[model samples]
Target: MHHAFQIADREINVALSRARTGYRLHLGERIVPVDLRTGADGRAWLTLGDAHIEVVVATRGDDVFVHLDGEAHHLRYRHPLDRLAAAAAGHAEDQIRAPMPGSIVSVAVAPGDAVTQGQVLLVMESMKMETTITAPRDGVIATVNYQPGQTFDRDALLLSLEPMETCA
Candidate 1:
């Protein structure tokens, strides 16, 4: 599996690759071997080429914080579907749509409500199964399109979100 990670402003790919000894990284025309050791205390060590580096890693959701060789790095895990969805949504990550035909069971947010990423926005039932709708990012709600007991088709717009302004 190949995973894309955002470090600062750049996106880097690290793949689970096969090599004669173990896993390797594909960097352009170069294949680099990596040796990694992890500890339960969040401390880790990496040996790349002739250099050995000590690192400490902490994570919260998609955000990762790393202390490596006296420097700190923050990164985010970008999902594969995120870019495709953004392109299809015209770069607007505001619209919340239903995944399938369902009826609203409960609503956890309202118009103008502030929500954090992964926070439950509502619950719905389809085919006798319940699912929770969550906020994709931190934002203020713009509209709640349906109330409890309302039925909607697949891909129906459930809500909209407005980006919250940051304090300068």
Candidate 2:
């Protein structure tokens, strides 16, 4: 099965295949084999590589929440056609927000810096997984809301682009 999930204004594609030993996950060019089992307490055990980690997962509507290590991550399912249509329409989100409670690991841009679409702006870590946040369109950075090591809550505004000017 193939799935797409939206996080931090971008979509990620995942492909899942079952095997006799475990499940194979295709993420872009990387293939990871994992085993998952749920306990009666609702917590799940995930075996990745040689590591066994406990996780909590819940689903609501099109949103899936994953609690790994000590942090939570929310991933929203996106229709593939929706992404194509949005890109074709050239619609871009001006603001980027925290997908879940996490701390900034690094920052690559500051206010007033010019950035292009998909340019890396910052890196954040939640549940020991690092996520890179990127610009959604070509624009100047309008705000720098947090610094490296600063923690943020889910939906917290992390950055914004200067409003595009229009000429009549």
Clashing pairs in 1: none
Top candidate by lDDT: 2
The sequence of per-residue lDDT tens digits that candidate 1 reaches over residues 1-168 is 446688888888566577665568776577778777786876688867567789777899999998887899899987644632442253276888876678999999988888887799999998798988778888888899999999997668889888788311
> On a 0 to 100 scale, what is the lDDT of residue 118 in model 1?
78
* Segments in model 1 whose C-alpha atoms lie over 4 Å from true places: 20-22, 39-43, 91-168
Tell me, what's the RMSD of every candidate?
11.5, 13.8
For model 2, how does the per-residue alpha-carbon lDDT over 35-111 read when each residue is reduced to its tens digit? Answer: 88998987799888778999888999989998898999999997543543253233356667776668999999998
* Model 1: how far residue 52 lies from native, Å: 1.4
